[model samples]
Target: MRRSMWRVMGLFSKKRQQSPSGSTSGQSCAATSTTSAYELQEKDLGRLHRAAAHGNLAWLRRWHWWLKRVSINRRDKEKRTPLHLACANGHADVVSFLVQENCQLNLTDNFKRSPLMKAVQCQQEKCVAILLEHGADPNLADADGNTALHLAVLSPNTAVAGLLLEHNANIDAQNQEGYTPLNLAVSKHHKEMVEFLQKKGADGHAQDQRERTALMVATFAEDMNAIQLLLWHGADSLIGI
Candidate 1:
């Protein structure tokens, strides 16, 4: 996949060089592809949305200057940095470059979510992966006392959850409602998430200050799969699973 992505971009590298205005470097790349009939610009913001959404190492590595000159400092009406855009859209290579070019990592705009937080919030799993590898603090909680782990489990994004956990996030971390990630997943009826956490040796028997165990929460959600999984994993029989 990576090689093919690069081959396409490399094929067009020279033709892309003649435009001196540099208005939008690497603008509408897919438009000219032999396989693609239409131009990307004729579309909506979804043009950039799709390209910038990929953690495209091909685009970043081949078009480093283009991305820097064109991609840097661009933002939407909400005043988020391009870093925020990259994070929200799951552009890890763009993210790494933006970060290398000194894009603000913790720059919180209207929503108070850093690029890292936004990545997790939007389920940009790869961006979350890259951000964690690039030193995003997993323990960083947001306004609602929700950690990245909290959101990961809610989405039941196993890869993101595992990546966050590998970075030493507090597994039993609680939120504003005293709901742990376990609580959130159980409440959402995410059977796989519950079982994965349990396999990771997560104390399903432990509750937040709210006295809600994973089994109790799963029972409330009527998640029989999660309930069964929790029971087999040594969750206290004293609870409601």
Candidate 2:
């Protein structure tokens, strides 16, 4: 997909360089050179992205001027900003620096995954805390409509889930499949996750697009422990019967 996008841009660049006189012979060479340079620049990571991905705070601070040229929030071809990389890689200090510099907190990547989502998905607890403290939206959904809380339940990280809930993440946020975090936890047989989400007040009775509740999912999976937990928490036992 990335290659195709670059190819299209190259064609457009050539077309744009066509002179009003409709003579492309002279401009052909210049257009080729320009397109190649643009592609190289886009393919290569800027200094800021490199530092953030590697957790090199010293390098970033020292070459801060270069960062200004590239823009602290400059996105790659994938539309992922340096802040996204920092959180995904668990660079708490880098995440802190970027947030303090007033980087956009709620920006989503090509997949619509926010920095907070990446932090939770990657199990970067410190990074998650930093992004949440800096006002990252825990409710932002990805292309699949999975929020940070959704990802947290998939990982079954109670620590991260706790932080998101404390920051007011929507416990019942549903994904594109209409499955809430509790539904996902039960389906994945994440006993601890189901317990944690229930404690946080997730709607155990919440149904998916298929009208299947967490209790139904547990029954389908034949997870006795999950079914026991769900029933203990007042999940309707006969919803899908």
Candidate 3:
């Protein structure tokens, strides 16, 4: 009787082990299927982004009707849409078409930079104008709180800066560091930009987070030309030590 009981117990243990193993295999297969589906979706989105960035207008037009199905505004892992890539790469035609398709004009990327900011960063003059003409916001700041005008001044692109100013970008816009466009120009010793910002009504007397004025910053850098321009603009030297 004892021998008979042992044989029954062994049979039960073996059946239990086999059932669990089969279930685990099925689960693993399901998980792999789910992972593959996600990868395919990412690849589709990446293809769209690459098409825009590379100026493949043919591909874009061929798939124009399918844009709504895949969502033209769908962002990648970095939250950058096709419009962002097109603007950054200076694809004016792509940008124009995308704009006509009613793509979000002010959609920001992961870094909170709008399409206009990307255009300015890449110095795409025509792309910048196209975006501005379609009413892209010039005052949207990036993750660093630097607006398109701030980047233009840093780039020393007087034409881009002028365009942004004409569109009502804040002349005295301050970044996260409280440094205005003029302050940035002064620090970078961009004489032309400093003059342009001052003419556009950028506050020469604006103080940074550390209470340092443009004139004070120029003085510290010992930039005679910057000092002269600031003084001419009536930048207060006594304040912001």
Using lDDT as the measure, the top candidate is: 3
Between prediction 1 and prediction 3, the one with superior TM-score is 3
Q: lDDT scores for all predictions?
A: 0.62, 0.73, 0.74
lDDT of 2 by residue, 1-241 (tens): 3443233334333434542422221121111111100112424677677778888999988887776676788888778888988888889999998887788988888878788888887889999898888788888878777788878877779999999999999999888777888888877778899888888788988887767677656654556677777767766433522
Candidate 1 per-residue lDDT, tens place, 154-210, comes to: 666888888888989888887766677776677666778878877777767666554
Q: Show model 2 residue runs off by greater than 4 Å.
A: 1-43, 237-241
Expressed as tens digits, the lDDT of each residue in 151-193 for candidate 3 is 8876779999999988988988888878888888877778999
lDDT of 1 at 30: 14
lDDT ranking from best candidate downward? 3, 2, 1
Q: TM per model?
A: 0.65, 0.79, 0.79
The TM-score of candidate 1 is: 0.65
TM-score for candidate 2: 0.79
Error of 2 at 161 (Å): 0.5
